[model samples]
Target: MKINPAHLGFDIDGVVADTGGAFIRIACEEYGISSLTLEDITSFDVVDCLDMDQGIIEAIFGRLLDDPLDAGLQPMQDAVSVLHSLAAKAPLTFVTARPHEEPIARWLEHFLQPDTFKSIRLIAMGVHDRKTSYIKNLGLKYFVDDRLQTCRKLAEAGITPLVYNQPWNKNGHDLPTVNNWQDIQALCAE
Candidate 1:
């Protein structure tokens, strides 16, 4: 399909970087809970998976303010290659549910070099509800995300959402799906 870069939107957590593992580990340590496997945490809401109230989750995240750069997060397979290719041809924006920018920026800086990070137009952060609206307002023609509910809502809102495959969202029966960045690149190229 040869989508123009201006039309694409990307989710950060599962799409660009693998934040799940770190998030789960931090959740466990901060909340004094046992480590959760992907299977155990997938069905639960983001906050519930951490076994903490929203307030505590926010506080734990805040503590990370000092040193948010967790070298533990690795880019999903083929993510950098695909992003590089796409960015070379078009604008790519990273839309995330992360509320803060500094930590996100620090994390990205640690993982992705300056040239790659600069290719991104903006890293939208904050609550999930606002993300859909942000994509709409920006006139994004397509979006890639790992959350089933988010993908469903994006599709319902009239945007083409390529649901990035995740074990947590595996039971879904909606939206177009991609297993990794390689698949996503092919989908966008089509």
Candidate 2:
């Protein structure tokens, strides 16, 4: 089924940004903690899946959330180009679970062209479970997220949630899913 750009919204972390890749990269580079792969992140809560210390897990995530630019967080492959294409049809909207908005906003600004970034509607709600209400408030009929639990909640709330494929969310749910930005672009027909 095709979805209009105006009716679609996205999650920032695993969906748009390669948060897991950055986490693994940081674990390998900064902390000298090699051996972690994207596939090793079997759970959304990294602490639950990896054998790493809780403190180190929290520290890595803290740096990512607090300063993604400094952490060198990169966008998912083709996300920028696909989003630019979608934005040309309608304003792009994003709702994230990050607490502070400024850091991510800066990150978006850094990647997106000024006019494209200016036209975006980004909401950093800081909580995972509450996106349904905010997404509804934004008049979004569909949202793409990588959290199975969040996608389930969105489904329960009557909004279609396209589960963004990820190692953490793999095989976790039966909802509709998009594996990459190209798949997402296909959903936005005309």
Candidate 3:
């Protein structure tokens, strides 16, 4: 089914940004933990899935949360181009669980064209749960997120949630999904 651009919203971390990949990279490069891979991130909470030190996990995530730009957090494949296309149709909306908006905002600004960045309505709500109200407030009928729990919550709240395909959320969901930005683009009606 095709959705209007104006009624669609996105999540940042796993959906738009390659947060898991960055975490793996940082673990391999700086922390000298070379055994990690994206597939091994079977859980959204990295500490739960990987047999790594909790302190190290916290430090890596802290770095990403504090300065995603500096953490070398890259956009998911084809996300930038698709976002630009959608932005031309309507102002882009991103609702993230990150606590502070400035860091991820800066990261987005770095990747998106200045005009696209200006057209974005980003909300860093700081909590993973209870995003239904914020999304409803934005008049979004559909939201794409990688966290199954959040998607489930949205679904229960009477919103259509597109589960952004990720290893961490690959199971325990029966919702419609978008595998990549190309799939996301197809979901948009021309």
Candidate 4:
């Protein structure tokens, strides 16, 4: 099969939505972590800074997955707009480590135009490194994600990885990183 060179991919949580702030808010309001902030989430794992129990974090993650498109989790408006524009020209796919597709599909549907995407791809990857295989199989020409590890893997596999800037991935500026959807729009326009 021939891969569509125009096919673009995105990551949920950080890149497409403000998962960091939403996560910290959930942790504080629901899990009783009163003093958490975005700065605390300097790493991919919240437990590293919040010092919260793994189970609690897991429960929160489950909640995020439970109603993945919860309105409280603010969608990145610029990204969605850019997505629609790109979708007008070519297919756009959202590839995520989220275990289920329905919630995200529903969530994305709420924000995007009718034809804004070709698919919402989900992977049962409990780790970042596992996404490389899915990207390869999908034959995505370009992939955007906030995790540096995933970006590295995509680059190693010869797929152009656009590193979405986030607090956790700020240090890895060496990667082909983008500051916002505007940067993505620019890249896709090229």
lDDT values, one for every candidate = 0.73, 0.94, 0.94, 0.75
Cα deviation in Å at residue 7, candidate 3?
A: 0.3
**Stretches of candidate 4 exceeding 4 Å from the true structure:** 1-5, 117-127
Per residue, candidate 2 scores C-alpha lDDT tens digits across 42-135 of 9998889899989989999999999999999999999999999998989999999999899999999999999999999999998998899999
Q: For model 1, which pairs clash?
A: 1-190
Give the TM-scores of the predictions, in the order they appear: 0.78, 0.98, 0.98, 0.85
Candidate 4 lDDT, tens digit per residue, 87-106? 76666666788777777777
Q: Per-residue CA lDDT of candidate 3, range 1-190, in tens? A: 8899999999999999999999999999999999888999999988789999999999999999999988899999999999999999999999999999999999999999999998899999989886899999999999999999999999999889999998999987789999999999998957
> Number of clashes in model 3?
0
Candidate 1 or 2, higher TM-score? 2
Model 1 regions lying over 4 Å from their true place: 24-35, 44-68
Candidate 3: residue 52 lDDT (0-100): 95
lDDT string, candidate 1, 77-127, tens digits: 788778888877775688888767777777766766578777666654577
